[model samples]
Target chain A: MSASDHLIPVVVSNVVEVNPIIKRFEFKHVNGDELPAFSGGAHIVVEMLDDGTKRKNPYSLMSSPFERDQYAISVRRDDTGRGGSKFMHEQVRPGMQMKISAPVNLFALDLRARKHLMIAGGIGITPFIAQMAQADKLGVPFELHYAARSVSQAAYMDSLADRFGDHVSCYCDDQGESVDLETLLSNQPLGTHVYVCGPKGMIERVVQTATSLGWPAAHVHFEHFLAPPVGEPFEVHLAKAGIDITVGAEQSLLEAVEASGTPINCMCRGGACGQCETVVVACDGEIMHNDHWLDEEQRAAKQRIMPCVSRFRGKRLELDL
Target chain B: MTIQFKDESFRGDFTYANSPSNIPRFPFPFPEDEYMYSTNIEPHHAARAGSPFENAFDVDEHYVAEMKDRALVLADDPGRCQALPHMETAGWDFLELVMVSKARDYPDLFKLTMDGDRWHWINKPLQIDDTFTFGDSSTLPCHPMEYIGRQVQGDHAILDQRDGNLWMDAGIITAQADWSLDFDIGMNFFEWHAPVPLAHELGVFQRALKFLLTLPQGQPSRRLNWTLTVNPRLDTSPENYPKWGPDRMTVTPENIGEKVHLRVELQTFWRLPRSNAILFPIRTYLMAMNEVVTQPKWGRRLHRVMRDLRPELVDYKGLSRYHPILVEWLSQFDDGAPTSPGIFPD
Candidate 1:
C-alpha cells in the first residue's frame, strides 16, 4: 500500500489561542467518521503542505481519549526553529483539510504504577492534559507539577486546576516559584512512575534527581521531541530506492527524501520515535547523531541513522532506505 | 454472504470436518516446497475476496462450534481466561475492538449499537444479546477480555510493552498449540518464546519484537504458523497432553488420511488503542489430510514441505511420532509436478 493510504484526512474544525505562543487546533475526520481511538500521551504527525513545502510535525493529543469525534493538539510556535508550528499557527484555519498519521503513543502511562506523577514545563504541559484525563477515568491517583515562566504563559493552567482541583499544582517563574526536584522526588510512594515532558534542561534535572533518589529506571519516563536542526547541505544516496538527493541546509533528510517521492515510514518527525531509522550502508563522513532513540553504542557503530533529524557531514553517504 | 453455522464437536467425538467448499480457503501455509523458521510476517490488509484475510476477523461455518468449544474449555479450566489487574483498560480495549470490527464486518452475524457509554451487542450466531456500559467491567458478566474472548474464535494474548520488551500480561488461551498461558502469563516476549528452537538464534524474535513494539494503531499484521495434530482437537495444550498425546500413536498408514490433521494458526497482531498493548490473536484452522488433498495444488505442496522440513521443527512441533508415516502417506499425492508460487489454489 502507498504510504498515504494510512493517512487520515482531517479538517481543522476549530482553533483556540491558548496562549501567545500556544495554539490548540481541533481536527475532525473529513468524512465525518469517528477518528481512531487513542490512549493518553498519544501523538499524531500532522502533514502540512504549505507554499510548496511539505513538513510533518508530531504533536501530542491534548484531548481526552474518550473523545473520538475530534482530536485536539496544542502547538507551541517556535519562531527561531523550523516552521512546522508556525505554519500551524498562521496558515492553518477552520475548514482547511490536512492529512495526519494515525495516533501513536510513544509516551504512555505505566498503568502498573501505584501512582502517576507528571511534571510539565511550560509548553510541555500538552501531553499531560490527556494523560490526566485517562488517569482520572481509570481512577488512578496522580498529581501534576507544572512549571511555567509566568501565569499568562502557562497553557491550560486554569482549566486543569478547575477540573483536577488539588491534584494540580502550578509554579510560575515570575513569582520565583519552582518545582524543587529533590523535595518532590524524595518521598513518593513505591511503584510511583514519574513522567516528565518539557524543556530539555527540566527533563534532565528531573531524571538526574530521580536517579539520585534511587528510583528504578523504569519508573522514570520522559519525552522530548527534538526539532530537526538546520545543518550544512549534504548528498545522500538511497541504495535500495536508487535515488540521489541533496539535503538542503535548511531541510531535514526525511523531508528531502519524501520530496523525492520515496516514502519513509515515520511517525514523530522530531528525533524521538525510532520509526524513521534507516540503515547506514556506507558513509565517508561523521554521522551526526541527534535522536534520543539511539544509544551511544549504536551511534558509535555508525551503522544506523534516524533520517528525521540526524545528519551526515561526510562526502559519500549511502542509506538502505 | 451468509454462513451456515456448524454444530460439531472438537473433543470426544472429533466430529469437526471441513466442507468441500471450505477446503480451498484453508490458508495452505506452505508457499514453497520446504519450510524453515523465518519472521514471515506481512501486513494484514484485506486480500482477495472470499479469502480468510478479507475481513478484520474471519467468521466461517465453524464460528458457532468454536465459540461453544471455547466455553467448554473455560468451564473445564477457568484459568484459561486471565487478565492482570493493570490490564483492565486493555481488556476493555480488546472488547471494543472485537465488537466493533465484527459488527462492521459481518453485520448479519453480529451487531453493535452504542448510545454513548451504553453499548448493545448482538451475536446472532452465538445467541448473545447484551447491553452494558462501555468502560465499566461491572456491567459485563466477566472480565472484558474473557467476556468477548469467549465470543470470538481464537486464543488472544495481550502483550504489555515495557522495558523495551513485550510482556504476556493477560490472555484467554484455551485453544493453543501446546503452550500453556497459565505458565506464560507474566513472562516477557523472549521468555515466553524461549521454548521455540532455532528462531532465537536466527534473531527472528528480536526483529519481530522490534517491529511489533512500534506497530501503529489501525495497521494490523498477520502470519501463518502450522503444525500437525492427531485429531480435530482444539486444545492441543501441554496441560491436557495426557488426554491427546496418545492420539499421535494412532496415526498409522491406514488412518493417516483420517486421523492426522494439519493445524494452521492465522496469527494476527493489533495495537490496542487505550492500553498500548498488542492484541495477539491465534486463530486455528484444522483440516484433515482427507480434506487437504481435495485440492491438488495443496496436496502436492504439503507433501514437499513436510518431506523437506527441518528435523528441529519436526521435533518442536511434536510431529516425530507420525512424521515418517505421514510423510510416506503424503508422498502418493505428489506427482513431482511444480506447484504454483503463492499460498493459493490453482
Candidate 2:
C-alpha cells in the first residue's frame, strides 16, 4: 500500500444538526478526488483526537455517494463512550479534520432479489435510507419498517415519511405500533432479500423471525454496528523480543502486545474495527481468528493475525515480526 | 501482570524463562516480532491432536448446542482472564462501540457496521424517480451528470483518489457511540437477539487486520508487492461457495473444498531509503485452511500444552514455546544455543 493508502484524510464541509442528540457531518475530498461510491452496507475507518482516548473507528455511511464531495455521518453524544462519540458531539464540527479508509461494502443490496424488505430499529434506518430512496426512484417494490421509542426520539422521522409515505411503516413501542418481525419476514417471496438494522433487539427479532420462518443465512442480511469480542486464547511468542506474552484468555493478541508495550500502529481495533494488524514470518497452528482483512482461506490459512481479537488453535506459536 | 517486550512496560515475572521446561529463542538480525511477521515463509504445520477448538473457545452447553455441538472454544472466562485483563474487550466495549457509534452517528452515515469488513449504508439510490434505476433498462435519460453521480458513489474511495480527511473527521466524531449501553443492558449472543456466531465472525475479521498491519511495507523499486499463496487442506467436506467480494473469483470460494490452495497479492506498499531497507524485503504470507489444515506432532504438542496449562489459559497457551524449541532441537537446526534477534534500533 502507498503511504497514501494509510493516509487518506477526510474533511467536513456541510454540517446538519439532525437532532439535539445527533449531528450529521458531510465529508469530502479537498483534493477534488472522486470518492468511492459505496453500497448501502459499507463503512469507512477514521482516526481522530478525543479528550481522553485517541484511536480509529469503523463507521458506516448514511449519505449516498451520488453527490459530489458530500458524505453525511450522524453522531450522538455519549460522555462515557470511549471518547469518539463525545468528541464528535462536543468537539467535532464542520471544517474539522480527520483521517479515513476507503469505503468497504459488506451489506450490499441484492439487485437479483426482486423485492427488498428494509427494517430499521431506532438508528438502523440509515443504511436502508439510500435503498428506500432508490427504490422510490426506480419505482421498485420495497417496504420500510422504522422503529423507535416514539416520534420525538426518531432521528429522521419527517424525511422518511415525506419521501416514502405509504410504502413506509413507522413503529414505536411507546406509541404501540411496533411491527412483529416474524410475521413481516414470514412466508417471504422467493426473490426477497432482508436488510435489518437498528437496535440489537430489532436486529435480533428480524433474524430470529426470518430464520424460524426458514430464510437462508444468505437471504437474511443484518449488519453488526459493534463487533462483539470472541474466540479462544492463543500463545503468542515475539521470537525477536524473546518474550512469552501470555495473552489472556479474554484479550486479543493485539491488546496483549500493546499492554506489553509494543507500539504497533493500529487503526480500527474492532476486527471490523481493523485498528491493530501485524505481520508474522513463521506461524504454526490453525489461526482461530476474527477479521475482515482476509478471505476465508487466508483466515484459516494462518498467515497473519489481528492481535486485538485473534487466537491460535494449538499451544504457543511464534510470529516472525 | 505480563512481560512486555518494549521495556518491561507492564508488570510481569517471566521476562525470559517462565516454566522450567520451556526455553525462548529469537532469530538473528531481525529487530523485533514485527520484522518476523513481514518477512517469513513459514508454513503453519498442522496438529495431530484433532481440532484445537476445545481450548480456543470457552464453550458452554448452550453455546455448544447452538453450534450443532461444535463450538470453537472462545477465551477462558474472558471477563476474568488472569494474565492480561486490559488486553481484552468487555460488555461495555460492545455496548459503547456497537451501540454508541451507531447512536452517535445516529441516523446518518451508514450506521457503522461490521461484516467481513467495516461497512454501512450508502443509502439514497441514484434518484428516487429515475425509471431505469437498477434493472437491465439502461435508458433512463440522456445525461452525463447522472453517470458522474454514480461514479462518486461507487468507486472513488477504493482508488485512494479521495481525501482521507473527510473519513478522519467522520470517524473521530462517532468515536464514543455508546447508544447500545443505554438499553438492553447485558447478555452475550444476541442480547435482545444479537447473533451468537458473531463472536466467531468478529474473530475472523480482527485477526485478518493484525496480519495486514504487521506486514512489512511493500517496495515498488523491486516491483515486489507482498503476496500470499494459500494451500488449504480439504480432503473432506461437501458444500461450496464460502466467501464473497468484488474479486469474487478470489473471494467467492470455489468447489475446491477443504485442502484448497490459492494465491493472492496483498496491496501493501513501502519504498524505504535504499540504505535502510531489509535485503529480504517486507511481506506477510497467510495460509487459512477453513478447518482443513490438519496438525502434525508439533501441532498436537502445541494444542496439548495449551490445554494442560488451561484453567489459567493465559500461561497455558503461552506454553507453545516448547513446540518450536522442541522442533528446532529435533530438527537439524541448533536449539540449545539459539541466537537472539536485535530488540531495537540496529
Which number leads on TM-score? 1
DockQ of 1: 0.68
Model 2 misplacement above 4 A: A1-5, A51-53, A134-139, A227-269, A273-321, B1-346
lDDT of 1 by residue, A1-321 (tens): 223348999999999998889899999999999998888888888888978888877789999998999999988888876778889999999999999888888899998999999999988898899999999988999999999999999988998999999999999999999999899999799889999999999999999999988999999999995578878899999998998999988689999998998878776777776778889999899999989889999999999999989888978999998
lDDT by residue (A158-237, candidate 2, tens digit) is 88788778878887778888887767777567888888877666778788888888887767777766432535556778
lDDT of 2 at B7: 17
For model 2, what is the error of residue B14's alpha carbon versus the real structure, in angstroms, after optimal superposition?
A: 70
lDDT string, candidate 1, B278-341, tens digits: 9999999999999999889888989899899889998999999889988899999999999989
TM-score for each predicted model, relative to the true structure:
0.98, 0.44
Could you tell me how far off, in angstroms, the CA of residue B243 lies in candidate 2 after the best superposition? 36
Clashing pairs in 1: A285-A314
RMSD of each: 1.4, 22.9
Per-prediction DockQ: 0.68, 0.03
Tens-digit lDDT track for model 2 on B1-346? 1212121100022121112111111111222222112222221222222211111111111111212111111121111101111101111121222222223432332133433222232322111222223222233332212222121110000000011100100000000101121122222122322322233444633343233322222212211121111222111011111311111233222322221222111222211111111111111111222221121222233223223332322322222323233223223221223223431112
